[model samples]
Target: MYILLILAAITAINLGKAFGTEKSITGKSEYALAVDVRVSVPSSAFSCMKKYGYKTVFVRGYDPTGDGKFDSNAVDNIHNANKAGLGTEVFMTPQPRSDKKGSQQLVELYEGLKNGDIKVKTIWVQVTSPVNWFPDTKINIDFLNDILSAAAHYEVKIGLYTNGYDWSQITNNAAADKIMLW
Candidate 1:
Protein backbone atom coordinates (compact mmCIF):
# COMPACT_ATOMS: atom_id res chain seq x y z
CA MET A 1 0.00 0.00 0.00
CA TYR A 2 2.85 2.38 0.84
CA ILE A 3 4.57 1.57 -2.49
CA LEU A 4 1.35 2.34 -4.39
CA LEU A 5 1.00 5.70 -2.59
CA ILE A 6 4.62 6.64 -3.43
CA LEU A 7 4.08 5.80 -7.12
CA ALA A 8 0.90 7.94 -7.20
CA ALA A 9 2.74 10.94 -5.71
CA ILE A 10 5.59 10.58 -8.20
CA THR A 11 3.12 10.43 -11.09
CA ALA A 12 1.36 13.56 -9.92
CA ILE A 13 4.64 15.43 -9.69
CA ASN A 14 5.68 14.37 -13.17
CA LEU A 15 2.28 15.40 -14.51
CA GLY A 16 2.59 18.80 -12.91
CA LYS A 17 6.01 19.23 -14.43
CA ALA A 18 4.76 18.20 -17.83
CA PHE A 19 1.88 20.67 -17.57
CA GLY A 20 4.36 23.48 -16.79
CA THR A 21 3.18 24.05 -13.22
CA GLU A 22 6.69 23.54 -11.87
CA LYS A 23 7.34 27.28 -11.71
CA SER A 24 4.61 27.68 -9.09
CA ILE A 25 6.39 25.11 -6.97
CA THR A 26 9.40 27.41 -6.90
CA GLY A 27 7.30 30.58 -6.59
CA LYS A 28 8.37 31.89 -9.97
CA SER A 29 6.12 33.23 -12.68
CA GLU A 30 6.64 33.88 -16.39
CA TYR A 31 6.76 37.57 -17.15
CA ALA A 32 6.66 39.60 -20.37
CA LEU A 33 7.02 43.23 -19.52
CA ALA A 34 6.31 46.37 -21.51
CA VAL A 35 6.26 49.92 -20.13
CA ASP A 36 6.06 53.64 -20.90
CA VAL A 37 8.39 56.30 -19.55
CA ARG A 38 7.47 59.95 -19.52
CA VAL A 39 10.70 61.60 -18.46
CA SER A 40 13.22 59.07 -17.24
CA VAL A 41 13.27 55.50 -15.90
CA PRO A 42 15.17 56.56 -12.75
CA SER A 43 18.05 54.23 -13.79
CA SER A 44 17.22 51.89 -10.89
CA ALA A 45 14.03 50.77 -12.68
CA PHE A 46 16.09 49.23 -15.46
CA SER A 47 16.84 46.14 -13.39
CA CYS A 48 13.18 45.81 -12.43
CA MET A 49 12.21 46.14 -16.05
CA LYS A 50 14.71 43.45 -17.03
CA LYS A 51 13.67 41.18 -14.15
CA TYR A 52 10.18 41.13 -15.62
CA GLY A 53 11.49 40.38 -19.15
CA TYR A 54 10.72 43.79 -20.59
CA LYS A 55 10.74 43.54 -24.38
CA THR A 56 9.40 46.92 -25.38
CA VAL A 57 9.41 50.46 -23.96
CA PHE A 58 8.06 53.87 -24.91
CA VAL A 59 10.37 56.72 -23.89
CA ARG A 60 9.61 60.37 -24.28
CA GLY A 61 11.64 61.41 -27.30
CA TYR A 62 11.93 65.08 -26.61
CA ASP A 63 10.50 67.89 -24.46
CA PRO A 64 10.56 70.24 -27.50
CA THR A 65 11.95 73.39 -25.86
CA GLY A 66 11.32 76.18 -28.36
CA ASP A 67 14.90 77.21 -27.73
CA GLY A 68 15.95 74.30 -29.97
CA LYS A 69 16.98 72.06 -27.11
CA PHE A 70 15.61 68.54 -26.62
CA ASP A 71 15.41 67.06 -23.17
CA SER A 72 17.72 64.25 -22.11
CA ASN A 73 14.66 62.06 -21.50
CA ALA A 74 15.02 60.21 -24.76
CA VAL A 75 18.78 59.92 -24.55
CA ASP A 76 18.69 58.73 -20.95
CA ASN A 77 15.94 56.17 -21.43
CA ILE A 78 17.38 54.95 -24.73
CA HIS A 79 20.64 54.02 -23.09
CA ASN A 80 19.04 52.40 -20.05
CA ALA A 81 16.42 50.60 -22.09
CA ASN A 82 19.08 49.33 -24.46
CA LYS A 83 21.22 48.13 -21.57
CA ALA A 84 18.18 46.29 -20.23
CA GLY A 85 17.64 44.74 -23.69
CA LEU A 86 14.37 46.60 -24.19
CA GLY A 87 13.24 47.89 -27.57
CA THR A 88 12.76 51.65 -27.53
CA GLU A 89 10.09 53.85 -29.08
CA VAL A 90 9.94 57.63 -29.04
CA PHE A 91 7.02 59.86 -27.92
CA MET A 92 7.51 63.46 -29.06
CA THR A 93 5.51 66.18 -27.31
CA PRO A 94 5.33 69.75 -28.46
CA GLN A 95 6.47 72.61 -26.28
CA PRO A 96 4.18 75.53 -25.45
CA ARG A 97 4.28 76.36 -29.15
CA SER A 98 1.45 74.31 -30.70
CA ASP A 99 1.42 75.81 -34.15
CA LYS A 100 3.49 75.63 -37.32
CA LYS A 101 6.65 76.38 -35.40
CA GLY A 102 5.84 73.56 -33.01
CA SER A 103 5.71 71.07 -35.85
CA GLN A 104 8.85 72.55 -37.31
CA GLN A 105 10.52 72.15 -33.93
CA LEU A 106 9.23 68.60 -33.65
CA VAL A 107 10.74 67.78 -37.00
CA GLU A 108 13.99 69.43 -36.05
CA LEU A 109 14.18 67.57 -32.75
CA TYR A 110 13.36 64.19 -34.25
CA GLU A 111 15.77 64.97 -37.03
CA GLY A 112 18.53 66.09 -34.73
CA LEU A 113 21.88 64.39 -35.15
CA LYS A 114 21.65 62.98 -31.63
CA ASN A 115 17.87 62.69 -31.27
CA GLY A 116 17.11 61.56 -34.81
CA ASP A 117 19.73 58.84 -34.89
CA ILE A 118 18.23 56.75 -32.09
CA LYS A 119 16.54 53.56 -33.22
CA VAL A 120 12.91 54.22 -32.38
CA LYS A 121 10.51 51.33 -32.87
CA THR A 122 7.67 53.85 -33.33
CA ILE A 123 6.79 57.48 -32.73
CA TRP A 124 3.75 58.33 -30.56
CA VAL A 125 2.44 61.91 -30.55
CA GLN A 126 0.53 62.98 -27.44
CA VAL A 127 -2.72 64.79 -28.38
CA THR A 128 -3.90 65.96 -24.97
CA SER A 129 -1.83 69.10 -24.49
CA PRO A 130 -2.42 70.26 -28.01
CA VAL A 131 -6.18 69.82 -27.71
CA ASN A 132 -6.44 71.24 -24.20
CA TRP A 133 -4.46 74.38 -24.83
CA PHE A 134 -5.01 74.95 -28.53
CA PRO A 135 -8.76 74.05 -28.34
CA ASP A 136 -9.34 74.89 -31.99
CA THR A 137 -9.70 71.88 -34.28
CA LYS A 138 -7.85 73.57 -37.15
CA ILE A 139 -4.89 74.41 -34.97
CA ASN A 140 -4.68 70.93 -33.56
CA ILE A 141 -5.22 69.36 -36.95
CA ASP A 142 -2.51 71.51 -38.43
CA PHE A 143 -0.28 70.50 -35.56
CA LEU A 144 -1.01 66.86 -36.25
CA ASN A 145 -0.58 67.30 -39.95
CA ASP A 146 2.80 68.89 -39.42
CA ILE A 147 3.72 66.14 -36.97
CA LEU A 148 2.66 63.52 -39.50
CA SER A 149 4.66 65.29 -42.15
CA ALA A 150 7.76 65.48 -40.00
CA ALA A 151 7.42 61.82 -39.04
CA ALA A 152 7.10 60.97 -42.69
CA HIS A 153 10.15 63.03 -43.49
CA TYR A 154 12.06 60.91 -40.98
CA GLU A 155 10.50 57.75 -42.42
CA VAL A 156 9.02 56.81 -39.07
CA LYS A 157 5.49 55.56 -38.46
CA ILE A 158 3.46 57.40 -35.81
CA GLY A 159 1.14 56.07 -33.11
CA LEU A 160 -1.31 58.52 -31.55
CA TYR A 161 -2.25 58.26 -27.83
CA THR A 162 -5.17 60.07 -26.17
CA ASN A 163 -8.28 59.54 -24.07
CA GLY A 164 -11.40 58.73 -26.12
CA TYR A 165 -13.62 61.77 -25.41
CA ASP A 166 -13.00 65.45 -26.23
CA TRP A 167 -9.55 64.62 -27.46
CA SER A 168 -11.20 62.12 -29.73
CA GLN A 169 -13.31 64.95 -31.09
CA ILE A 170 -10.03 66.47 -32.21
CA THR A 171 -8.18 63.34 -33.35
CA ASN A 172 -11.45 61.73 -34.55
CA ASN A 173 -12.43 58.07 -34.98
CA ALA A 174 -11.46 57.82 -38.63
CA ALA A 175 -7.96 57.31 -37.27
CA ALA A 176 -9.04 54.33 -35.16
CA ASP A 177 -6.49 52.05 -36.77
CA LYS A 178 -3.60 54.27 -35.64
CA ILE A 179 -4.86 55.10 -32.13
CA MET A 180 -3.25 53.35 -29.18
CA LEU A 181 -5.18 53.43 -25.89
CA TRP A 182 -3.16 53.86 -22.74
Candidate 2:
Protein backbone atom coordinates (compact mmCIF):
# COMPACT_ATOMS: atom_id res chain seq x y z
CA MET A 1 0.00 0.00 0.00
CA TYR A 2 2.84 2.40 0.91
CA ILE A 3 4.71 1.57 -2.28
CA LEU A 4 1.58 2.27 -4.34
CA LEU A 5 1.13 5.61 -2.59
CA ILE A 6 4.75 6.58 -3.30
CA LEU A 7 4.36 5.66 -6.96
CA ALA A 8 1.22 7.80 -7.25
CA ALA A 9 3.02 10.73 -5.65
CA ILE A 10 5.96 10.36 -8.03
CA THR A 11 3.62 10.19 -11.02
CA ALA A 12 1.80 13.30 -9.90
CA ILE A 13 5.10 15.16 -9.44
CA ASN A 14 6.28 14.10 -12.86
CA LEU A 15 3.05 15.22 -14.44
CA GLY A 16 3.33 18.58 -12.75
CA LYS A 17 6.90 18.91 -13.97
CA ALA A 18 5.81 18.10 -17.52
CA PHE A 19 3.13 20.78 -17.36
CA GLY A 20 5.54 23.50 -16.09
CA THR A 21 4.27 23.45 -12.52
CA GLU A 22 7.86 22.59 -11.65
CA LYS A 23 8.74 26.19 -12.33
CA SER A 24 6.68 27.17 -9.33
CA ILE A 25 8.53 24.62 -7.26
CA THR A 26 12.00 25.52 -8.49
CA GLY A 27 11.33 29.27 -8.73
CA LYS A 28 13.07 29.46 -12.08
CA SER A 29 13.01 32.15 -14.70
CA GLU A 30 9.82 31.65 -16.71
CA TYR A 31 9.57 34.99 -18.49
CA ALA A 32 12.20 37.24 -19.98
CA LEU A 33 12.77 40.30 -17.78
CA ALA A 34 11.76 43.56 -19.40
CA VAL A 35 10.60 46.89 -17.96
CA ASP A 36 7.84 48.59 -19.97
CA VAL A 37 8.24 51.97 -18.24
CA ARG A 38 4.56 52.58 -18.71
CA VAL A 39 1.92 53.08 -16.04
CA SER A 40 2.59 50.01 -13.92
CA VAL A 41 2.13 46.30 -13.89
CA PRO A 42 -0.39 44.49 -11.77
CA SER A 43 0.56 42.89 -8.47
CA SER A 44 0.65 39.45 -10.05
CA ALA A 45 3.43 40.42 -12.43
CA PHE A 46 5.39 41.92 -9.58
CA SER A 47 4.96 38.77 -7.52
CA CYS A 48 6.03 36.47 -10.34
CA MET A 49 9.13 38.48 -11.17
CA LYS A 50 9.96 38.67 -7.51
CA LYS A 51 9.75 34.90 -7.25
CA TYR A 52 11.90 34.38 -10.32
CA GLY A 53 15.32 35.89 -10.77
CA TYR A 54 14.07 38.37 -13.37
CA LYS A 55 16.97 40.75 -13.93
CA THR A 56 15.04 43.15 -16.13
CA VAL A 57 11.49 44.52 -16.21
CA PHE A 58 9.76 46.96 -18.54
CA VAL A 59 7.63 49.94 -17.41
CA ARG A 60 5.11 51.52 -19.77
CA GLY A 61 2.67 54.46 -20.25
CA TYR A 62 4.79 56.93 -18.38
CA ASP A 63 3.54 60.48 -18.73
CA PRO A 64 6.21 63.12 -19.19
CA THR A 65 4.35 65.95 -17.56
CA GLY A 66 3.59 65.96 -13.88
CA ASP A 67 0.41 67.94 -14.52
CA GLY A 68 -0.82 65.61 -17.25
CA LYS A 69 0.21 68.15 -19.83
CA PHE A 70 1.95 65.85 -22.32
CA ASP A 71 2.26 62.61 -20.48
CA SER A 72 1.86 63.63 -16.88
CA ASN A 73 2.22 60.14 -15.53
CA ALA A 74 5.56 59.38 -17.16
CA VAL A 75 7.83 61.25 -14.80
CA ASP A 76 6.92 59.07 -11.86
CA ASN A 77 7.36 55.98 -14.01
CA ILE A 78 10.88 56.93 -15.04
CA HIS A 79 11.74 57.51 -11.43
CA ASN A 80 10.18 54.19 -10.50
CA ALA A 81 12.20 52.28 -13.13
CA ASN A 82 15.38 54.00 -12.04
CA LYS A 83 14.72 53.03 -8.45
CA ALA A 84 14.13 49.44 -9.51
CA GLY A 85 17.38 49.36 -11.54
CA LEU A 86 15.60 48.64 -14.81
CA GLY A 87 16.64 50.26 -18.06
CA THR A 88 14.03 52.59 -19.55
CA GLU A 89 12.96 53.29 -23.11
CA VAL A 90 10.42 56.06 -23.58
CA PHE A 91 7.66 55.22 -26.05
CA MET A 92 6.43 58.46 -27.60
CA THR A 93 2.84 58.28 -28.77
CA PRO A 94 1.86 60.21 -31.87
CA GLN A 95 -0.34 63.25 -31.19
CA PRO A 96 -1.38 65.93 -33.65
CA ARG A 97 0.86 68.95 -33.22
CA SER A 98 -1.30 70.93 -35.67
CA ASP A 99 -3.62 71.88 -32.80
CA LYS A 100 -3.19 73.46 -29.39
CA LYS A 101 -3.71 70.19 -27.52
CA GLY A 102 -1.15 68.45 -29.67
CA SER A 103 1.24 71.35 -29.40
CA GLN A 104 0.98 71.01 -25.66
CA GLN A 105 1.71 67.34 -26.02
CA LEU A 106 4.80 68.20 -28.03
CA VAL A 107 5.92 70.51 -25.28
CA GLU A 108 5.34 67.70 -22.85
CA LEU A 109 7.45 65.41 -25.00
CA TYR A 110 10.29 67.92 -25.03
CA GLU A 111 9.98 68.37 -21.30
CA GLY A 112 10.04 64.62 -20.76
CA LEU A 113 13.36 64.33 -22.51
CA LYS A 114 14.85 67.46 -21.08
CA ASN A 115 13.97 66.77 -17.46
CA GLY A 116 14.68 63.06 -17.52
CA ASP A 117 18.15 61.65 -17.52
CA ILE A 118 19.89 60.53 -20.70
CA LYS A 119 19.21 56.92 -19.71
CA VAL A 120 16.50 56.82 -22.39
CA LYS A 121 18.70 55.26 -25.08
CA THR A 122 15.82 54.34 -27.35
CA ILE A 123 12.69 56.33 -28.17
CA TRP A 124 9.90 54.21 -29.65
CA VAL A 125 7.20 55.96 -31.64
CA GLN A 126 3.95 54.26 -30.57
CA VAL A 127 1.89 53.74 -33.72
CA THR A 128 0.00 50.69 -32.67
CA SER A 129 -3.48 49.49 -33.81
CA PRO A 130 -6.53 51.77 -33.80
CA VAL A 131 -4.16 54.69 -33.30
CA ASN A 132 -2.06 53.07 -36.02
CA TRP A 133 -3.67 54.74 -39.01
CA PHE A 134 -2.60 58.30 -39.69
CA PRO A 135 -4.95 60.91 -41.20
CA ASP A 136 -2.57 61.05 -44.11
CA THR A 137 0.77 59.43 -44.81
CA LYS A 138 2.30 62.89 -44.73
CA ILE A 139 0.83 63.52 -41.31
CA ASN A 140 2.54 60.50 -39.91
CA ILE A 141 5.75 61.27 -41.73
CA ASP A 142 5.81 64.85 -40.58
CA PHE A 143 5.10 63.89 -36.96
CA LEU A 144 7.77 61.23 -36.99
CA ASN A 145 10.18 63.66 -38.60
CA ASP A 146 9.56 66.23 -35.93
CA ILE A 147 10.14 63.71 -33.16
CA LEU A 148 13.23 62.34 -34.86
CA SER A 149 14.63 65.80 -35.30
CA ALA A 150 13.95 66.55 -31.66
CA ALA A 151 15.64 63.33 -30.57
CA ALA A 152 18.62 63.93 -32.82
CA HIS A 153 19.00 67.43 -31.48
CA TYR A 154 18.79 66.02 -27.95
CA GLU A 155 21.47 63.38 -28.73
CA VAL A 156 19.02 60.52 -28.41
CA LYS A 157 18.25 58.01 -31.15
CA ILE A 158 14.72 57.54 -32.55
CA GLY A 159 13.10 54.29 -33.63
CA LEU A 160 9.86 53.77 -35.56
CA TYR A 161 7.45 51.46 -33.77
CA THR A 162 4.86 50.06 -36.14
CA ASN A 163 3.59 47.01 -37.97
CA GLY A 164 5.63 45.75 -40.92
CA TYR A 165 3.85 47.74 -43.64
CA ASP A 166 4.00 51.04 -41.81
CA TRP A 167 7.61 50.49 -40.89
CA SER A 168 8.42 49.60 -44.50
CA GLN A 169 6.65 52.71 -45.68
CA ILE A 170 8.69 54.92 -43.34
CA THR A 171 12.10 53.33 -43.97
CA ASN A 172 12.12 53.48 -47.76
CA ASN A 173 13.97 56.79 -48.07
CA ALA A 174 14.27 60.04 -46.11
CA ALA A 175 12.68 58.45 -43.05
CA ALA A 176 15.56 56.19 -42.15
CA ASP A 177 17.55 57.19 -39.11
CA LYS A 178 17.85 55.09 -35.93
CA ILE A 179 14.68 53.07 -36.15
CA MET A 180 13.72 50.84 -33.20
CA LEU A 181 12.16 48.63 -35.92
CA TRP A 182 9.52 46.71 -33.96
Candidate 3:
Protein backbone atom coordinates (compact mmCIF):
# COMPACT_ATOMS: atom_id res chain seq x y z
CA MET A 1 0.00 0.00 0.00
CA TYR A 2 2.82 2.41 0.78
CA ILE A 3 4.47 1.66 -2.56
CA LEU A 4 1.20 2.24 -4.37
CA LEU A 5 0.73 5.55 -2.54
CA ILE A 6 4.21 6.72 -3.55
CA LEU A 7 3.55 5.82 -7.18
CA ALA A 8 0.23 7.69 -7.11
CA ALA A 9 1.92 10.75 -5.65
CA ILE A 10 4.61 10.74 -8.32
CA THR A 11 1.98 10.37 -11.03
CA ALA A 12 -0.05 13.21 -9.59
CA ILE A 13 2.99 15.45 -9.48
CA ASN A 14 3.87 14.66 -13.08
CA LEU A 15 0.33 15.31 -14.25
CA GLY A 16 0.24 18.62 -12.42
CA LYS A 17 3.49 19.68 -14.01
CA ALA A 18 2.21 18.75 -17.44
CA PHE A 19 -1.02 20.74 -17.02
CA GLY A 20 0.92 23.67 -15.59
CA THR A 21 3.01 23.80 -18.73
CA GLU A 22 0.06 23.91 -21.09
CA LYS A 23 0.20 26.76 -23.59
CA SER A 24 -1.55 30.08 -23.04
CA ILE A 25 -2.36 32.91 -25.49
CA THR A 26 -0.70 35.86 -23.82
CA GLY A 27 2.13 36.69 -26.23
CA LYS A 28 2.62 38.46 -29.53
CA SER A 29 3.38 35.20 -31.29
CA GLU A 30 -0.33 34.49 -30.86
CA TYR A 31 -2.81 36.29 -33.12
CA ALA A 32 -6.54 36.49 -33.94
CA LEU A 33 -8.13 36.06 -37.41
CA ALA A 34 -11.41 35.60 -39.21
CA VAL A 35 -12.31 32.85 -41.68
CA ASP A 36 -15.80 32.68 -43.13
CA VAL A 37 -14.92 29.97 -45.60
CA ARG A 38 -18.44 28.64 -45.71
CA VAL A 39 -19.30 31.52 -48.03
CA SER A 40 -15.91 32.63 -49.32
CA VAL A 41 -13.17 31.27 -51.53
CA PRO A 42 -10.66 29.43 -49.33
CA SER A 43 -7.42 30.51 -51.01
CA SER A 44 -8.60 34.05 -51.27
CA ALA A 45 -9.98 34.04 -47.74
CA PHE A 46 -6.75 32.78 -46.25
CA SER A 47 -4.84 35.29 -48.35
CA CYS A 48 -6.87 38.06 -46.77
CA MET A 49 -5.61 36.97 -43.36
CA LYS A 50 -2.06 37.08 -44.65
CA LYS A 51 -2.61 40.46 -46.19
CA TYR A 52 -3.95 41.67 -42.88
CA GLY A 53 -0.82 40.20 -41.21
CA TYR A 54 -2.68 38.00 -38.74
CA LYS A 55 -0.42 35.34 -37.28
CA THR A 56 -3.42 33.08 -36.95
CA VAL A 57 -6.19 32.35 -39.49
CA PHE A 58 -9.51 30.81 -38.59
CA VAL A 59 -11.17 28.59 -41.20
CA ARG A 60 -14.70 27.37 -41.50
CA GLY A 61 -15.03 23.62 -41.76
CA TYR A 62 -14.36 22.36 -45.28
CA ASP A 63 -15.90 19.50 -47.15
CA PRO A 64 -14.04 20.40 -50.31
CA THR A 65 -14.96 17.21 -52.14
CA GLY A 66 -18.72 17.58 -51.60
CA ASP A 67 -18.67 14.20 -49.89
CA GLY A 68 -20.78 15.57 -47.04
CA LYS A 69 -17.77 15.23 -44.73
CA PHE A 70 -14.29 16.68 -44.38
CA ASP A 71 -11.76 14.96 -46.66
CA SER A 72 -8.24 15.21 -48.12
CA ASN A 73 -9.08 18.60 -49.50
CA ALA A 74 -9.18 19.78 -45.91
CA VAL A 75 -5.55 18.70 -45.69
CA ASP A 76 -4.80 20.51 -48.88
CA ASN A 77 -6.16 23.68 -47.39
CA ILE A 78 -3.85 23.29 -44.42
CA HIS A 79 -0.90 22.81 -46.76
CA ASN A 80 -1.91 25.87 -48.70
CA ALA A 81 -2.08 27.88 -45.49
CA ASN A 82 1.37 26.65 -44.47
CA LYS A 83 2.78 27.58 -47.84
CA ALA A 84 1.38 31.02 -47.23
CA GLY A 85 3.34 31.07 -43.91
CA LEU A 86 0.29 31.54 -41.70
CA GLY A 87 -0.86 29.34 -38.85
CA THR A 88 -4.19 27.65 -39.59
CA GLU A 89 -7.21 26.87 -37.38
CA VAL A 90 -10.72 25.55 -37.97
CA PHE A 91 -14.17 26.63 -36.80
CA MET A 92 -15.98 23.39 -36.29
CA THR A 93 -19.74 23.35 -36.96
CA PRO A 94 -20.78 20.17 -35.33
CA GLN A 95 -23.27 18.11 -37.39
CA PRO A 96 -24.49 16.03 -34.46
CA ARG A 97 -21.95 13.95 -32.52
CA SER A 98 -20.85 12.65 -29.14
CA ASP A 99 -17.61 13.53 -27.38
CA LYS A 100 -15.98 10.41 -28.73
CA LYS A 101 -17.17 11.21 -32.23
CA GLY A 102 -16.03 14.77 -31.96
CA SER A 103 -12.57 13.63 -30.87
CA GLN A 104 -12.43 11.20 -33.77
CA GLN A 105 -13.40 13.96 -36.15
CA LEU A 106 -10.56 16.08 -34.82
CA VAL A 107 -8.19 13.14 -35.17
CA GLU A 108 -9.19 12.82 -38.78
CA LEU A 109 -8.77 16.54 -39.24
CA TYR A 110 -5.35 16.49 -37.57
CA GLU A 111 -4.26 13.55 -39.66
CA GLY A 112 -5.18 15.37 -42.83
CA LEU A 113 -3.45 18.55 -41.73
CA LYS A 114 -0.30 16.82 -40.48
CA ASN A 115 -0.04 14.55 -43.50
CA GLY A 116 -0.38 17.56 -45.78
CA ASP A 117 2.36 19.41 -43.92
CA ILE A 118 -0.11 22.02 -42.71
CA LYS A 119 0.55 23.38 -39.25
CA VAL A 120 -2.69 23.96 -37.38
CA LYS A 121 -2.55 26.35 -34.42
CA THR A 122 -6.10 25.99 -33.18
CA ILE A 123 -9.72 24.73 -33.73
CA TRP A 124 -12.77 26.68 -32.59
CA VAL A 125 -16.30 25.34 -32.46
CA GLN A 126 -18.84 27.34 -34.47
CA VAL A 127 -22.31 26.89 -33.13
CA THR A 128 -24.30 29.44 -35.11
CA SER A 129 -27.81 28.02 -35.28
CA PRO A 130 -30.25 29.73 -33.00
CA VAL A 131 -33.23 27.87 -34.37
CA ASN A 132 -32.23 24.35 -33.48
CA TRP A 133 -30.18 25.71 -30.61
CA PHE A 134 -27.87 22.73 -30.91
CA PRO A 135 -27.25 22.14 -34.57
CA ASP A 136 -25.76 18.78 -33.85
CA THR A 137 -27.08 16.74 -30.98
CA LYS A 138 -23.58 15.39 -30.58
CA ILE A 139 -22.39 18.83 -29.52
CA ASN A 140 -22.58 19.14 -25.75
CA ILE A 141 -20.47 19.93 -22.71
CA ASP A 142 -18.87 16.52 -22.89
CA PHE A 143 -18.10 16.98 -26.55
CA LEU A 144 -16.52 20.34 -25.94
CA ASN A 145 -14.39 18.91 -23.19
CA ASP A 146 -13.28 16.06 -25.41
CA ILE A 147 -12.38 18.36 -28.28
CA LEU A 148 -10.47 20.76 -26.06
CA SER A 149 -8.64 17.89 -24.40
CA ALA A 150 -7.73 16.52 -27.82
CA ALA A 151 -6.62 19.92 -29.01
CA ALA A 152 -4.29 20.20 -26.01
CA HIS A 153 -2.92 16.77 -26.74
CA TYR A 154 -2.19 17.83 -30.31
CA GLU A 155 -0.84 21.18 -29.13
CA VAL A 156 -3.50 22.98 -31.09
CA LYS A 157 -5.51 25.76 -29.49
CA ILE A 158 -9.21 25.11 -28.96
CA GLY A 159 -11.81 27.82 -29.46
CA LEU A 160 -15.48 28.53 -30.16
CA TYR A 161 -17.24 31.32 -32.11
CA THR A 162 -20.80 32.53 -31.89
CA ASN A 163 -22.81 35.73 -31.86
CA GLY A 164 -24.13 35.15 -28.35
CA TYR A 165 -23.86 32.43 -25.73
CA ASP A 166 -23.94 29.48 -28.10
CA TRP A 167 -21.18 27.69 -26.26
CA SER A 168 -22.22 28.73 -22.79
CA GLN A 169 -22.70 25.11 -21.85
CA ILE A 170 -19.10 23.93 -21.94
CA THR A 171 -17.27 24.29 -18.62
CA ASN A 172 -13.62 23.64 -19.48
CA ASN A 173 -12.91 27.33 -20.17
CA ALA A 174 -10.55 26.38 -22.99
CA ALA A 175 -12.58 28.47 -25.37
CA ALA A 176 -11.39 31.51 -23.46
CA ASP A 177 -7.90 30.75 -24.73
CA LYS A 178 -9.01 29.27 -28.04
CA ILE A 179 -11.86 31.39 -29.32
CA MET A 180 -12.43 34.54 -31.42
CA LEU A 181 -16.03 35.73 -31.39
CA TRP A 182 -17.50 37.06 -34.62
Which numbered prediction scores highest in TM-score against the true structure? 1
**What does candidate 1's lDDT look like per residue over 1-182, in tens digits?**
01101001111232213445555565334444467675566555766666766666767666655543465666777787778777666766665343446567666556552543565446777666433445456666666677677767777777766666746566553344443434
Candidate 2 achieves a global lDDT of 0.49
1-182 per-residue lDDT for model 3 (tens digits): 01001001111122212345658623333224433344333565456657976454445453422222454345655556656777656756654333235566666677666676666787666655544334443445555566667777898876555544444433322235424443
Q: Which regions of candidate 2 deviate over 4 angstroms?
A: 1-31, 35-37, 40-51, 60-69, 97-107, 116-119, 130-132, 166-175
Worst 10 residues of 3 by lDDT: 1-10
**Which residue pairs clash in candidate 1?**
none
How well does each candidate superpose onto the true structure, as a TM-score?
0.65, 0.57, 0.53
Model 3 misplaced regions, further than 4 Å: 1-35, 38-57, 61-68, 81-87, 97-100, 130-139, 168-182
Better of 1 and 2 by lDDT: 1
- What is model 2's C-alpha RMSD? 14.5
**lDDT comparing candidate 1 with the true structure:** 0.58
Q: Which ten residues in a row have the lowest lDDT in candidate 1?
A: 1-10
Position 110, candidate 1: lDDT: 69
Who wins the lDDT comparison? 1
lDDT per residue for candidate 2 within 1-182, as digits (tens), equals 01001001111133212454455564333334444434444445444544554444433332433333445556565565455555446666655433434334444566665676535666666655433435456665666666666666657666555666545454333355435454
Error of 2 at 171 (Å): 8.8
